[model samples]
Target: MDSKNYIDSGILELYVYGALSEKESMEVSQALQQHPEIRAEVEAIERSLTQLSTAAAPYQPDQVYQQIKTKLNFKDQEVAMIPITRKRTNWPAYIGWAASVALLIGLFIQFDKNKELRQEVVQSQIEKNLLEGKIQVAEEDLTKTKTILSVLRNKDVIEVPLQAQQVAPEAYAAVYWDKESQTAYIDVAGLPTPPPGKVYQVWSLKLDPLTPTSLGTLDSFNEEATKVFALNNANESEAFGITLEPEGGSESPTMEQLYTLGVVNS
Candidate 1:
């Protein structure tokens, strides 16, 4: 495993706590030698645990001795020393063992809390990113809506409604032509969704000579929520037509696949 995955696996904590079996401990030791990062992590864990244990265990030898003497009912007066071998409570040993247990419990609790905190931070970041992405998308949509509204309200813009052709009787679309800016905003909301591997290509037509100029393909048709697209049109277009073409469009209009057509009002 990589160093990061190895460190995150919690085995290093167990190794430091001496809770791992002999074989596992040997393996960890090998890793510690091979990986500097693992060694550093182990050292850091050891330092933290040592600090916690030390802070929790305050050593007051004199106080402990006095307390022990008080508990034993001992007096300062000198008396004959006699060795009595009887079962007695080992208070010092018991206190040391209890302190060790408490230290271990405290370390375990701290480890668990730290893990929870890390998880919370990661989850919070994910949520934050998702919210930001949504906000960005909303902002872009708002900008597009504002631009479209402005175009529609312009007095100089020419509106042409492209009626459904025989190929697709139910499919219709409209074009807002701004001659000043040479921009054509086509609203394809009334048109049916294009099938897979096919796209809707727009054309600027001159009906007098039946000449067709390719504006562009609606490549982002499926992704566009408003079903509106803007394409550059510098040609003196007398008419507009939409045709279904293969992906990336074609060099010439496929007249048989024409979905909509409309002539500019004189």
Candidate 2:
């Protein structure tokens, strides 16, 4: 383009304000070197900006135009001056501020998403631990049930049914006595729950003179889920009897509180 068209294109104003890209600025620099008129226009724009910055009062277009025409010594009606608009915007400054605000908003959104994901991961791990605890408890209960079934099916164990006595007509029990092991497993499933501070005491009985020897009391009766208890019976017992006694059990049999009785088969 010729000097007159290039001057009117507004690139000189952009170059002076540092708003043009590096490549465009370099092109303008080359044009300024090649053409003396373009160089003079750039210098004039710089001088006008410097004057406006130092001026005491707000700009008046007509006054500034007359000042410029007289300083350049333009003859009347010979040089036509383009009207300069007073309103100018700093586009690069506004664009930089907008980019900073966009970057902050993006960072805040990403931080919120990461926080939600971390909470979800922690909650899932807690649920997994609770499920594993429940599974372990179930496995332990299954093993205990299998052991009870094996004891009941043993052929070598002698089964003796104890009949309910006058003190408790509805209460009954059975004993699976392993003679070789001298271990008596008392199945008290049909008995009622013992009252507080009370316990069931077993006795090894000899019918000839009606002598009774005390076995240990069922201290953990309420806590046993299967209502069965194992007790060591090393005495030569002809009959087995159960009676209600105090917590620690009495040294002798409590005849009035007898609940059940059974004779061993020869």
lDDT against the true structure, each candidate: 0.85, 0.80
Give the runs in model 2 whose Cα sits over 4 Å from its true position: 1-140
TM-score of 1: 0.60
Candidate 1 lDDT over 55-76, as tens digits, reads 5555444454455346445554
Quote the lDDT for 183 in model 1: 98
Cα lDDT of model 2 by residue, 1-266, tens digit: 59998987677865776545677778999999999999999999988775665443353445554555575566567434432333434333454567678889999999999999999999999999999998997786677677667678988888888999998999999887888888888888888888998999998889999999986898988877777778898878888999999989999888999999999898
Best candidate, TM-score-wise? 1
Superposed by TM-score, candidate 1 places the C-alpha of residue 146 at a distance from the truth, in angstroms, of 1.5
Clashes of 2: 0
TM-score of each: 0.60, 0.49
* Model 2 TM: 0.49
